[model samples]
Target: MNLKDLLEEEKRVVINPLQDENPPLLVVITEGSTTLARALIYRILIDETFGPNQSIHFILYDSLNFLAFLESTAIEITACAPNLLEGISYSADSSIAFKDADVVFSIGRARGYEFTKNERRESFFEEYIHVAKIHGEAIERFSKKDVKIITLGYTAARIILQFAKSIPPENITALSLLTLKITAALIAAKANRHPSEVINLITWGVNGENSLPDYRYAKFRDGKFVEEEIKNDVWLKKNLIKGVRSASGRSWYSRSSAYALADHCKLLWNDTPKGEWTCMAIYSDNSYGVPTGIFFSFPVYCQNRKYKIVQGLDVSENLKKYMKETARIINEESSIALNAHR
Candidate 1:
C-alpha cells in the first residue's frame, strides 16, 4: 500500500478504536457559570456518571473572577481521581477554551446581566444574544466540526441557532431535561414511586414556564412497565403544570439545574435506557406544527450517540393549541434576539 494510505489507516484506527480498547479522549468545555461548572465537574469526577473508565479533559471557561475557583476545582479533581482526571484547565479566552472541544455546556446568563422577571422580554433576548454569538463563533472557529453544544436556557439556544454563523443547527440543543426531571419526580411522588421509574414523560413545547408536561405516554415500573395511574388523576391534569412552571423560580435552581445539565450530558454520551425516551429543546423541522426553525422541546430517543425526535405520537387538540402558541413566542423571541445580532 502507498505511504499515504497506510497513514490514513493508522489515523482511523486511533480515532475509532476497537470495543475493548480505550476510546478517544473527550474534551468538554463549560462556558459561563463557575458554580454550575464546578458542580458538573464534581459529578463527572466523583460520581463518574459518564462511566468510570472514559477519559475526559475539561476546560472551565468564564470571567476572570472565576479563575481561582476553576484552579481549586482542578486540584480537587486531581486529588480525587488522579488517573481519570486526564487534565483540568481554566480559560477566560473563548478561543483557547473551545479549541478541539468535543462537548460544550453554555449554561449561564450573560456575565454582566442580572435579569429580573419585570424586565422587558425583548431586552432579555438582546442581552443574552451576545453570549450565544460569542460561544457560537468560538465553537465554529476552534472546536471540532461536530461538537455537541448543550445550552441550558431556551433563549440562548434559540439565539445561537438563529444567528450563529457556520455552526450546525443539529449540533446545538437547549437542555429541557430539568423540566423533565421535575415533572417525573412530581408524578413519581403522586404514584409513590421513585423518579427514575417514571419513563417516557415528555416535556414539550418550550423549556421553562408555559411548557407542556405530557403524561399520555408516561409509564412507571415496579417490576414491569405499567400505565401511570397519575395520568388520569386530577392532580396530574391540574397541579403538575403549576409545579413545573415554578421550578425555575425555586431557591435550588442553580445546583439542581447543574445536575440536570450533567444528566443530559451523560445521556448524550451514553445510550439512554431501552424502551424509553428523553426530551430536549432541539431545532424543529415542522414536526407537530412547531415552526420550521425554532428550538422547541420534544421527546427524543438516543441511539448510536445521536438523537431522533420521537415521531407518530398522538397530539390532542388542546396540545396543538399550546404548540401553536409556543411557536409564536419562539419566533417572536428569535426575531428579538436576531435583531440584536444585526
Candidate 2:
C-alpha cells in the first residue's frame, strides 16, 4: 500500500469505534453563565430523564481551557457523580473521553438584546454568522473524531426576536409567529422581550417530521390565537434578514432558562419526547429545499441511538417563500463565517 494510504488506514481505528470500546458522553459548552459543576449536574439529570445510562463516562470540554482543563474538571465531575449516579461515570482521561461517546453538546453564547431591543438591530447579523461558522467547523471535528453519535444543543433566539420586533405587528402572520415560537426561549429571557402579552406563540412537529415539516404555529394576537397564512412578500423580505441570529454582545437572556433549554435539548437528543417537541434551532442542508447547506430552526428527532431530520411533509407556498428567504440569509452568512478568517 502507498504510504499515504497506510497512514489513512491507521486513522480508521479512531473513527466510530464499537460502542463497548467508546466513551459515552462529551458536552461542549462555553461559560458565559454555564460552569463545569453546573454542566455536569445537567448531564446527570438529563441522563436520568433520557437514559444516558448510569454506566457511561461523560467528558466535559471546557472551551475556556480546552482539553487542558480536563484533569481538574474531571475531579469535580467525579465528586458530584457517585452520590448522583444511577450508574454513570465521569472522566478526564483523553483516551476514554471520546470512546463510545454518542452525544456532543455544542453550545456557545449570543449577542443579547439588552444592549438595544427596538431599533434595527442589524449589527448582530454578522456576529451570528460568525457563530454559524464556528459550528460548521465543529461538525467537521465531530465527524472526523466521531466523539458524538447523537449531537445536541439549541440555537440563540435573540436575532429572531430583534427582527420580529422590527416589523408591524399587523403585517406579522402565523408564519412569523411560528418562527418566533421556535426561537421564543431565547427571546423570553431577553430584556424588553417576553412572549408578547398580546401574542403568545405555539408550535408542534408532525410526528417528529421537521424537514418538509408537518408543523403549525399560532399567535395569541388580536385577543386570541389562530393560524393563518401570510401572503406579503415585500413585508416578509423586509423584516426577515437571512442567516441573522446568534450573538454574544451583552447579557439579557435568562441564565436559568438557557441552562434549562440546553439540558432539555440533551434529553430530546436522546429521543425523550416532550409535549409538542423540544425546540431547537440549528443549521440545515437540503431538507426543506432551502438550498444544500445553511442552518435554520426546525423540530428534529433522534431514535435508536441516531438522529434523522423529521422529513417528507408539505410546506405552504407562503411558508416556503419565507423558508427560502431564511435560506438566502444562511447562504450569505455561510460565506461570511467560512471566509472571515481569510
Taking all chains together, each candidate's TM-score versus the true structure is: 0.85, 0.48
lDDT digits (tens) for residues 70-161 of candidate 2: 44454455455442232323222222333333443433333222222222246464455444334334333332343332211112222221
Cα RMSD to native, each candidate? 7.9, 12.7
Model 2 lDDT, residue 326, Cα? 51
Which candidate wins on lDDT? 1
Indicate the worst ten consecutive residues by lDDT in candidate 2.
168-177
**Regions of candidate 1 where Cα sits further than 4 Å from its true position:** 1-26, 31-33, 110-118, 121-125, 162-164, 222-228, 249-252
Model 2 alpha-carbon drift over 4 Å, by segment: 1-33, 36-40, 43-52, 63-101, 109-145, 149-251, 254-269, 272-279, 282-285, 311-314
Cα error, candidate 1, residue 35 (Å): 1.5
Error of 2 at 130 (Å): 8.4
lDDT of each: 0.69, 0.36
lDDT of 1 by residue, 143-170 (tens): 8877888887666776666545567887
- Angstrom error at residue 21, model 2: 12
Candidate 2, residue 36: how far the Cα is off, in Å: 8.5
